[model samples]
Each structure stands twice: as structure tokens, then as C-alpha cells.
Target: MEHSGKNKTNGFLLMLTLLSVIAVVAAPFVWDRFMEGQTGMIALIVVEVLLVIFIIASSHSLWKNSGSGEWKLKSDKKGMRVYTLKNPGETWLKIKIIGRLKARLASILTLMRNPDAADDVGMFDSYYIDGWDPDKDGVDPKLVYYTFKQKLFPPFKHREFVVKSEFSQDPVTKEMKFNFVAAPDKLPFNKRYHRVTEMHNRWKYTPLENGEVEYEFIYDAVDPGGNFPYALANWLIPAMLPFAFAKMPKILDKEKYRNAKMDYVQEVGEPAEAMA
Candidate 1:
């Protein structure tokens, strides 16, 4: 439920911005009544001062909150850490953070927000390479992302997020977390970071306590295969998203017995010999 400093700040600012606009638009209405009046002049000055004061106060808050909540991606030299990790089974990238309270809160927000939209099948996620700090800023391991392969990745950069699940006798709750999108100007590191658009869904098949094979759903997004490479790849993997959704359930149920265990088939060699 916690939001990143970046997201919370922006969300807060968005509300402020909207209100400012409303004030500006309504200024004329006020002017119509009070134009040329002493009262109008006093009111106008007060409003202008209040707006300026609000902006200044917010900027100051942002500066104090600005260390890492989301304004920009800082490199190690700037005290931010970086890292990248890949396993045959799992591919993830992460960043580390030291001791900024607000920064830590922002970090929490990021962890929760990433994989922003992964379902039982797949998700959309993003993060910097674990160790490639352009500015030497510390990175949080939790600030890692995944790769999703498709003919064409979405035009925008994805996000970071997480999900937690609970089970019960007859009812259970599934919880998910998310963070705010990075403002275009706030992404401090690389534009593409030499990465390409990518996405994927984790397929799982597990036998339930009831002798049925139930599955756990998970998803992630990654950067890989540029337009040219994807073109050559023949759009094969990317095109499967729809099919992934449609057939995932069927794939788990392909066999009539979700939990049927196999014993053994008749021995072909011995049986054939016996028949002969």
C-alpha cells in the first residue's frame, strides 16, 4: 500500500496542479465582480502570493524528498547502487539504497508497484541493470525488473510491482501492489540502456491437495529484441500473448485427470514376445 516517493510526490503534485489550473481559470470570474475595486486588488494580490508560496513550499518538499523517491536515476558516484542478476530459471535486475527514510519509503513503493500488471500468466515490469550505475547511486535489489519477449513491446516503459497470495478453507485473498509511472523527465539513466522490448508469462503446474493439478500464475516484462531482431524472429513469441491466455487453462487441463498419476504401460518387448 505504500507508494514510492516519486509516485506519491507526483500524485500529490498532480492534485495540486489541477487545483492551480482551476484557480487560474476561475480568476476571471472573480475579476468580473471585483474589477477596478480595491477589494478586488487585495484579493488578487493575496491569491497570487498564496499560489507562489504553495509552489515554493512544494518545490522545497520535493528537494528534501528528492534524494531518490523518483525524480531521477542516480549513479554510484552519486551514492546509488546498481546490479543485474540472471539465472537459467529466473532473470532479474536490481538496485540498492542506503539510508534515506523517504527514499526507503519510495523504494517500498517501487517494489510494490513493479510487475505493475502481471496476472496468473504474465506481467509488465521494469528496472535498471543491477550494477551499471551511470552516476554511482546506490541501488536496491528489490528494484529489479523482468524481460517479456514479444514481436513488439509496448511504446512506453513498464514498471515495478509485486503480489502476495493467501489461501483458506473455502475463501482466500490475493493481494497485489503497484507504484506510479516514471515521469518522462525523471528517468535519470539511459533511454533504452541498450535494452529492447520484451515480455513473458511464467507457466506453472502443481498438483493440489485434492489430487488435482492447479497452477500458480505469474508474469513479467523485459527488454530484448529490437524491431529488426523481432522481425527476423518472425513475431513468433510476441504473437503468443493472446494464445497464452486462451490456452493456458487448457494446457493445464489437456489431460482429463488433473491429478491422475501414471502406473505403467504393458512391456512391449515382453508382451510381444509372449504373444509370438
Candidate 2:
């Protein structure tokens, strides 16, 4: 877990590094050209589209194969890595519960992060879980809610459980969301849910210097005891501040609270202690 936290901090730093380069080196060129052609309606559209793509690519889970199996995540580092456990034949894998950790992972936000303003598939502030499926021939412990949610049943083919929940509230957008996507169309399964019953908590140590750390206690909501959703939440999650600030004018001194140090979080590491 200690090493995992370090990895997350590293990955976030890498992401921030990538964005800073984009801003300091790339933005001026693009902005200059954009302003010159600002009067052209299509040019403005093109620039906006480019910016949106740039933001999404920075803040969401795009996939690649890792080791023996496929991994779906924006970064394979801790605090921001997602893992979806697959069925291993007759052997059932025992997964440690880290829902709280997963939430902490995605909850950390940085000033460098730009909110995803281009996701038309679904819209929300935090993690977005869009798909799910159960009893798909090889799944170890099948999920009942997804099984029923995707049903073609004779009235008596199912059972229901009473479920309950509290909420994760994002103050900036005044949004209350409770789930994060696990498979995101990149995995074998076709269903999704929040990583757990509770919302993941994130701590932003430095919001001013555009550096920070995050932790998440993600629930394995898709398959209560399964590893897929929990893994996916951690690996794929990214900073939500970028999207939240999409429409607003950039104000480093005033509108930098979310990106500022997260005093509400617990001590995990000194990686983000250098933020200004």
C-alpha cells in the first residue's frame, strides 16, 4: 500500500508535467493562431474541439495491455489506477476490500487538471461507471442487480435486496454523484457501478503549485466482492478539477481552492509537500 501510494503520486506528477509542457510550450502557439483566426466561426470550433480533446485525454481512462492481461486505466500508478478482475476458471480470486482507498485515489484534484468538457456519452463530476453484466459464462461471483437490470424474465426468475446509500457531494458544481465506471467499454464485461457503497475521498496537498496527492476508498459495487470494479476505479480515475473549471475564466489566486491544498485529507506522503 505504501508503494502503491508512491506510484499514484508519481503518475499524477507525470500527468501534471505533461500538461505544464502543453501550457508553457504548446498553448502560446495554438492561442496565437487561434486569435488570428478567431473571427472565422469554423476555426473557433476547431480550436475548441482540440482543447476538449486535450482535456479528455489528460483526465480520463484510455487503455493498453499490461503484463499478461489487459488493464484499463489512465495511469497504472497508485491513487489513479483501475483494475477489473476477470474470472479465472473454477478458481475464485479473493480480493482485499479497498473501497475507501479507491475513493481517496480519485478524489485528489490538482490545478493542472482540466475538466472533461467533451464527454457526450454521459455527464457527471466524479467517476462515471457506464456499463455492467453478470453470469456472462465465466464471471466468478455474479452480480444480482446487473443480472436483473439486464433481464428478460418470466416474473419469478429473480430476487431483490434492499439497498441504501449516502452521497459524495462536489461543492464547486454542487453535484452529488455516487459511482465510478469500472470497465468503460474497454473490458470484456458489459456492465458497471460505483466501486463501493461509499464515495471515495481525495486529499489535495498542494493546489497552488499544480501539484497534489490523492487517495480513494472505492467500493466494488459491480460485483460486491469482485476485483474488477475496484481495480478499474483506481486505475482509470483522474482529477475532476479541469472539467469543473472548463467554462470559467482562469483565476489562479481566486478560483484555485479545489486545486489548492486539501486540508481535510490525512497524511500519506511528502510527495506533494512542495506545492506553492
Top candidate, metric lDDT: 1
- TM-score, prediction 1: 0.24
Identify the runs in model 2 with alpha carbons over 4 angstroms from their true place: 1-25, 28-30, 33-37, 40-45, 54-61, 64-95, 98-220, 223-276
Encode model 2's per-residue lDDT on 1-276: one tens digit a residue.
Answer: 975785586577557747754664565457655465536656655655676666554443312211223323332432234333333221211112111111121233222121332132123232212232222454321121121121112432222112221234343322223333332223233234322222222222222222332223333333333233334433333343223333222333333432345322222333334321
Give the C-alpha lDDT of model 1. Answer: 0.35
All candidates: TM-score? 0.24, 0.21
After superposition, the stretches of candidate 1 with alpha carbons farther than 4 Å from their true spots are 1-18, 24-204, 220-247, 251-276
Q: What lDDT does each candidate get?
A: 0.35, 0.32
What local lDDT does model 2 show for residue 159?
Answer: 22
Model 1 Cα lDDT, one tens digit per residue, 1-276: 344666776678867956876776677577747565777787787887787678666644543343322222223332222222222222232122221111111222222222332332354343333333323456332233333211234653333222221111111111112222222232333444333324342322332333333332333334332333322222443233334534333433423223322111111122322321
